[model samples]
Target chain A: MDHPITVDSDACTRCGICIEICPMGIIAQDGPDDLPGLVPGGAAVCSRCGHCEAVCPAGAVSARYPACGPQHLPGGSAAIAPADLAAYLRARRTVRRYREECVDRETVEALLDVVRFAPSGMNGQPVHWLVVHDPAEVRRLAGLAIAWMREASRAGHPMADLFGVLVRTWDAGVDQICRGAPHLVIAHADAKNPMAYTDSIIALTWLEVAAPSFGLGTCWAGFFQMAASASPALAEALGLPEGHAPQYAMALGYPAYRFPRVPGREPVRVTWR
Target chain B: MDHPITVDSDACTRCGICIEICPMGIIAQDGPDDLPGLVPGGAAVCSRCGHCEAVCPAGAVSARYPACGPQHLPGGSAAIAPADLAAYLRARRTVRRYREECVDRETVEALLDVVRFAPSGMNGQPVHWLVVHDPAEVRRLAGLAIAWMREASRAGHPMADLFGVLVRTWDAGVDQICRGAPHLVIAHADAKNPMAYTDSIIALTWLEVAAPSFGLGTCWAGFFQMAASASPALAEALGLPEGHAPQYAMALGYPAYRFPRVPGREPVRVTWR
Candidate 1:
């Protein structure tokens, strides 16, 4: 079979760089046109790595990702410039504290306007968002989340210590850590679908990236999401649809604190092939 | 728990727009610190949504994502201008096919370099990449993947029909449906961690958004990832660590075809609160 990306024979330079760079070794000379072409006379196999495309200096090759097609967006194809990407990547953060003010309905609608544009699996668009602004409802949900954590803790889950912190905070008459933030954006997808997490993460990432440009802070509330998924009352209060599982919950608000410098960390591990 | 952003009180106008615009209802009017200050007691729950900052006429608020901190990059704070954001959102896609030619090593390295900067759950950074370049190794892994599928088919799984297609394709001596794309980028994370998929998705999304800027195409390959996770031979061939589990995969290549128009889609369901 022809690889999803086919080379134009007319533009062939045969530099062999593609063969060397292929992470999967699917590209080869004199390969069968059918039966996954990289297998040698039905002997070899290709991993479908695009290293060859990146390595080719002749500009003679072209590649395509499957399942992606033209006309995929509401307004059509618009290119994101490098500068914009740099800005977007630089601005996103996971926020914890918030100012004690209420966000207006208009601004929430505006942010949703951009979030609706987030990409989905196979264009299935399975992602759904529940925006909670009422202080009472947010707190109620947080209570339910703590209850779930207590259950998990009793079960000896490894992260029980973290849950203990939340429990203690609530018990000490401190603010409800989960609901203290005024805006709770809960992202959900069909629980039955394997790709639900992917859908939620993709949408959440889009929202997080866009938030910085709007001057808001976001925190990925895994505890809340897990609790929502585990507790039907919390799910109902959050307005998650039946059969839809909450994958991520983000708390949005203004910052209550400041740091003098970026937190320190060890160097990252990276390999060059 | 202080949030990561703050507004300069001296620069405040008390116009009430920030409170109204905040998605998280953390902003409120209160006399704290012996002065009428926009106390951020609730800001600790911020999602970093950016609405308050974006709408602020005076630009008093500033937030910085942890990954884009001063120590990592030279910029004090980066924000994608509105026009640039419009362009970036427009260009995103999920590509699958690829050209037969090789991609430059430096270019692939550059892409990986950006991915290295992606955030992880609690800075775990458990995610690992298996870049397959050798055509033979790619083929070996693909064959093992097909074998796994065949085994699943014999067991009478629901996806038997899909596997039947693979069998028929292989029998007819045609190309693998995965395409003969020469490169495959596999992302794996710790199996024990709940955030493994989150880490993988974040890194992959970063790469996907950045690929178009370099004239490359990408497609997420969940099926391939599943196969690798389920089959030990495939996992070993791909060099996945003992405790690591595959979370996501993608095919990359040069585009053999281009469509003149962006694809159309149904309007996403969005609620404005």
Candidate 2:
């Protein structure tokens, strides 16, 4: 990983913008007019946040580690207006009931493509996704979650009462664990990676937030995540990548209903310093 | 707490949709055909997730807990298209250098308004905010973070080398901690609330993702967060609620430069089961 960054000297203006923009303070210039490069031993401590590449005014800097790709955006500061973006964010809802029709791979892949850009600590980008593409497999996972809850209820755990209710609800065939959604998307990472949990949740949040614009809906699968954390049976069934655990799970599908109105939330509390 | 949900009888069709839609399964109907209402002790168990309210075909069911508000989406599912939303999200770039202009109270409040709808654990919605509004105060906080880093560097901390570099960078007059942004937004919550950390980060992420639309920019103040977590000097200066701790912080201000293209991220890795 020597010199994880490269400079297109053909386009370089020796402006030192990349050197100044490096979050790791790893890039350096030999003189005021010299082309910038990583200081000695820079790659070892580089956070891979890609600030150097993105901040290059001439597009002369490129970070090599993640494999950079070109992306075109609606130019200037007007991609979408403030009002429109606010409206879209406010309209997002935690979908409970999903249509039985299966979601296509291309649509789901598009979602992952958008989500891959979601931020991570030091740009570790450790999260990998597990999509339970088969609705039947999702159902099996939900059933295993219910099984864990029943055991917890029998053992009188701290949340035993709630578990009892969930178990009874499952018995009544409500499929509340996964909300009977046609698919489940789980973000997994090595348990050893300190950033894995927060990073995965952020990516999932981005996925859930962006899904609606894709003509899809998502719900945080809290029940399944709870069971997965402690239930070996459920974990074994999930068969996540070796050395990895599911950080969070999201119920993904086309929603069965449309929500035209955005519901209120608790009044925001703030302290101005 | 009784009857947290209300129904408009005129608008109600007795269609059994609300009864089936209640996530708590607390709504019930009587006889061959009956209007749905909360069963005995319904409100206590209600997750307040607003499924019944959002799922109603006639908009007859309203959850009193959240004080439901009328929100007009672009109408139908035609808000922003998938590709456009992805483009906008991808275009988001964290600001390291920002214009000196101060952010207005109205604009900050607007951002908070949109963020209030961000989902939380079981609708717990525990997060509150702290705005270090003055640029001078933001600088003070950044200096405090540097002070902490200096102390960490003095000791043989595992991250001592990185801290030493940051401390030297600070001594050389680069405000890397908060990036000299005009304002800092810190999400905080009661230490007892388990959902606080994740909820706060999600809300902050939403704020980061949507800032570009508002002609503003943000960077996760990871350095400030590091100091806030373990530095008594920083914590006392933050002056959060008595029972609360700062979950995460973001540096916010107008950008010094525009990012014309979306930078690439790591490849999307997925397992389909």
Candidate 3:
């Protein structure tokens, strides 16, 4: 609630990029020479998305909502050409084959450092990450999910058939849950907020897309996510923050193989109005 | 599902990338000269993720699940260096202000062409797109969303307070719902599959990130999405395919201004297990 919009007067050039870039249109300048200030009640409307600070040419403006001010834009323009980005996204594959070697904590940390920038509704940024670093722990968590599915199957739940296969797979020493990945990343947020669910998915998708850049690959842990959402035991095992529900999970690790091409996909199904 | 994973004997170099990349671990070859084939009952377990086709260096494998074959890898590697990609993702911003000029149809199509490659649950790829191109139609849809909010406010719903503000803003001609955006892109999918909801969000997230490359910007149309989800009338107005629910909506247009820098964000919050 204590969102501060600060300006470095000596460095301010009054270019007004921050004012123009503000989504809420709340930043204002009295004159050409004037430093921009938040309009009356601007803080209340501010989503704390940080456009003002990010758009400032002189690094003169800082939206100190989180207290971490703007970072230096490394190597000037941080943009990948559009075509290159599209190709990168296209060429990405859901990595199921992961090397036994565990990814170091720092690499995962660095990846999340970038993924945390993924957009959230009203910039709520409610998604919090839970990284299961220990491979044994990841397997144990998968076991918890299997246990839940086993119970559900016994109860003749609607997903009983799916659960039966998963439990059977687990019994056979096949990991249909976490895909034998060395690391698992779970996104959790307030369960009551509808936006939180979508936001978490967006964040996880960003993590999945960005992981390959870090020599890591990720697969959505659908089975684990199913159990996490339904089983209190799994939730308790995760020990996520209070009042938070697991939104989704991703199995992450160094991929055992590399993808060389972008696959052909279903034609774009669009109904243009 | 008749998911045929075939390999071209002539083109295959027998490097075995496809076999290694298969998430199901079902792709096999008896010897170096043997062409890769599915193990017994492999098709039953195949997630249809197309990893075999994407990873094959010789462009020999084809997971023709949807009858789509492998696409040529445009150039060898389209990957942006990790640091550049991280910086690019970090620099993204939600654009509220828009230029009057409408984005060309071709640009939108090209953007979607790339977005079609976005990953989905089990490669289900259920997310379908509805693009509202005409500015007048976009405004009319916004009006309908406002009307829905007005009714909800009148009904004294729990969200009435927020809807009341949105309705009032609409009345003031401030265009809060669509933000006067010339185009609106919506992602809708089968309501029964919970994965579709998350997949839609991921697809839209990809769209948002890829938009700037097309010289456009997008803001999540939360207000419109809320109404689209709750009001049958709005859903009918959207004319989404039968049995489909609107997962989310995004307002798209040429940005009024360019953001010069990436905004500051909250420190990455993680619970390392």
Candidate 4:
């Protein structure tokens, strides 16, 4: 493959910063005066980590991002203070109660954009997102999940007790499934991929961690995820692409309540070798 | 579990904020001037999410944290700027190459402390950590993983091709298994726990995200994890508590290089329902 990056000679100083910065050592400058390009077979091995384009001192190294079109964005820095970050992590709560409001499209989009940088197995970013945006749609999906739980309960599944409790709560007009959250975000990938479960959960974890920064709240929608994995009806409802299946999900919305204190947890159990 | 919280009568304002904020509605105030305590059977249902103690205005309420002792800490606010957080997320990279220096114990401790707040299924918080602080130990464990891979390769295992590549690299001078990182952090839980995989991965995701905050870097040790799951030798080397098995691990250290730019990713894929 030709060089993934196109160097504009006018702006190129040929300093080789990109070559050194390339994580895969793919970018090469044949001669000190020549512009940087990918080494032979470089494209096949490139993880597309974007380190080359990011470290370029000159504005000349532009790599094609077929997904977003070609764009060279500067690397982000650790601007947050340690103390504030400590507080931020401590402040996060598993928000199960949400106000009857929807997060605007732009805000949700921005949050996903941040998590897009979350790492995946071998940089094989196989996770795709399915945003259940409308509250009604979320409600319908939750119903399908309940449908599975109800059947599982009748069939005496291993988790029958838990399913029975949830189904009863749902029947009693409580949403134990999605927790009445207005939005549900599902992370999915090709079911055949071994890394799908881990990558999807990692991406969702990133989303939940970053949600509060946008004044939003989230809870792991485990019940929905469990049903999505088991119930063909729920799978049909999700309508993921041809080979994709849901691995995990989160209920998303404006929090109706507040967690005003940092509750202490069990002393971390660690064995240092 | 007599009222997990102790309310000081003299300092109690009896505003019922605790009652209102309790996610389980377990906290109760008998009279307008009365101190708050758990409702009948409330303790049984309480998730110990700590919302009641956090929401109290008076310094009267203190929750007993066996893990942390009796303390009521103020809830942290979202003090981080959204833009800064966006940049922080973008700046993160999966460091495959690491500097040889070891991270101090205090820094590793601080990172784990922040992750203690990460959520778990049913508030189980079942994940425990094992930090391999010795580089030699890490190398030894990597050799065990290589041994498993070497056997798998000879047996023509399904992943034999991938295992072959890793084993060949290990036989070479390169440290392909642990990436030569000074420390390895393993997240483990009871093998019987259904939530172990998701919960452990979520916890490790928290760790990797929080690592950058401590000027530390991490790479998911998937090969090591795979071997640990299948190899009795690696499991015996791990020495996790009885019935606990390794779920995931990360190579922890300072990065050898810097990523100066944020590489472009494929455009975000979303299906709006």
Candidate maximizing TM-score: 2
Q: List the residue pairs that clash in candidate 3.
A: none
lDDT of 1 at A5: 52
Report the lDDT tens digits of candidate 2 across residue range B159-260: 898788788878888888898799999999998998899899889988987788888999988879989988999999998879898899999999887666
Displacement of the residue B120 alpha carbon in candidate 2, Å: 0.8
The C-alpha TM-scores of every prediction are 0.68, 0.94, 0.91, 0.90
- Tens-place lDDT per residue, model 4, B5-101, is 7788888888877776665657888789777888788767877766666656665677764663223333444456667788887788777778899
Q: Chain B TM-score for each model? A: 0.68, 0.94, 0.91, 0.91
Per residue, candidate 1 scores C-alpha lDDT tens digits across B1-273 of 555556677887777665654545567666343212235566556655454554456656555434422333335445555435544554454544457876776676667766665666655666777777554555566677788888889999788987777766656754353455566777777789887888889888877777776677777765577678788777777766678777887776665543233333334455434
* Between candidates 3 and 4, the DockQ winner: 3
- Chain B in candidate 3 has what TM-score? 0.91
Fnat, one value per model: 0.25, 0.64, 0.77, 0.65
Residue B111 of model 3: what lDDT?
92
lDDT of 4 by residue, A30-49 (tens): 78898778778887887776
- The worst-scoring run of ten residues by lDDT in candidate 4 chain A lies at A68-77
Candidate 3: misplaced stretches above 4 Å?
A: A1-3, A7-36, A39-41, A56-60, B1-3, B9-20, B24-36, B39-47, B65-67
Residue runs of model 2 more than 4 Å from their true location after superposition: A74-78, B31-33, B74-78
Structural similarity of chain A in candidate 3, as TM-score: 0.91
How many backbone clashes does every candidate have?
Answer: 115, 0, 0, 3
| Candidate 3 C-alpha lDDT tens digits along B1-273 | 465788889999988887767766788999888887998898888877777887777777877777465766676566577788887888778888789899988899999988898988778889889999999999999999998889889999898988888888788887889888999999888999878877888899889888877778899999899889988778888988879899889999998876666776778889999
